[model samples]
Target: MSELPVLIYDGDCGFCTRSVRWAERLPVRMRILAWQEADLAAYRTTPERARHEVLWVAPSGRVFGGAAAVAELLRSARLPWPVVGWAMSAPVLRWVAERVYRWVADNRSRLPGATPACQLPPEQRPGHRHGS
Candidate 1:
């Protein structure tokens, strides 16, 4: 089989690399890798399009972006984080998420490696790659 849906991220970003590394170790046992280094043309995103956002490509060819992608990834792993994910569907939560999305988009460059993201702290991040 192909693998869990791939997460396309900027490999050069410390936050992106760190987050992918963390996802790589989730109990879900799936592959989620950095797209900047991988051949994901099949995912059919313009480099310009991808640089601005997180991405997820489902087995059925569904694509998700931003907070939706995050929620899908957590649900794909069946992670407890998805519990909060459900709440995110609520209008108020989604409004907050949209605001959060805008802020992340605006400040992604300030992160380590000047990439648009950051890894969560070691203790709070998933344990597979870091070893629980």
Candidate 2:
């Protein structure tokens, strides 16, 4: 509800926490919150969606998910980071980035710093259920 943008992620996921730590290292000003503790309804998002992917909720109420959320986070950082963020949002790159993000999200439990909690719930996983 503050003026700063809000970033929501799976708190139980060690990989997600580690990724957030990396994001925190960047010189960006925003609110980073765990989905379990946050009021998802305030962000106009559902718990299921928040559990499944990283989210960026703008102060104005716009929402970005998956790789798009990553791009927005980078855009909030300083200098070269914003450039990288712009590239991520570029047409062809956005397509590639989205797929890469999905791959990472699907395999996060196998990634470094990950814990069993990093694995998505079977019902929330791609192909196992519908909607994004």
Candidate 3:
């Protein structure tokens, strides 16, 4: 219901929390709320959706998820960030960015600042259940 963009991120993951804190320094005016504290219904998102990916809700009522949401946020930021955002929005680069984002999300617990809970369950991890 806010007139500004809203960045919805996972609160329980230490890596996510750290990343959000870093993102707060971006030169953009937006509200950043943890998914646990957000009104998901207002953003046309469900708890499951929020749990799985970051979301960006625009003032114009557009909702972007995953890497696109990140790109949107960067686009709203100033100067160099917007340049990076434009690169992410490009066709081939966007495809690569999406894949990279998903890989990072799947391996977050192995990343710096991550806690054990940041790791996806074995069954839920990419290629684990499918035996890839």
- The TM-score leader among the candidates is 2
Error of 3 at 109 (Å): 1.3
Candidate 2 pairs with clashing backbones: none
Q: Using lDDT as the measure, which candidate wins?
A: 2
**Candidate order by decreasing TM-score:** 2, 3, 1
The digit string of per-residue lDDT tens for model 3 on 43-97 reads 8887777778899999987889899999999999999999898999999999999
Q: What number of backbone clashes does candidate 3 have, counting pairs of residues 3 or more apart or in separate chains?
A: 0
1-132: candidate 1 lDDT, tens digit per residue: 254676776554566666677776665545565655555567765455455677777766676777777666767666576676676657888788767876875566575555323443323333213221
**TM-score, each model?**
0.71, 0.89, 0.88
Tell me which of candidates 1 and 2 scores higher on lDDT: 2
What is the C-alpha lDDT profile of model 2 across 7-82, one tens digit per residue?
9988778888999999999999999998877888889999778877899998889999999999999999999999
The lDDT-based order of candidates, best leading, equals 2, 3, 1
Q: What are the root-mean-square deviations of the candidates from the true structure over C-alphas?
A: 9.2, 4.7, 6.0
lDDT of the structure predicted as candidate 2? 0.87
TM-score of 2: 0.89
Query: Which portions of model 1 miss their true places by more than 4 Å?
Result: 1-3, 112-132
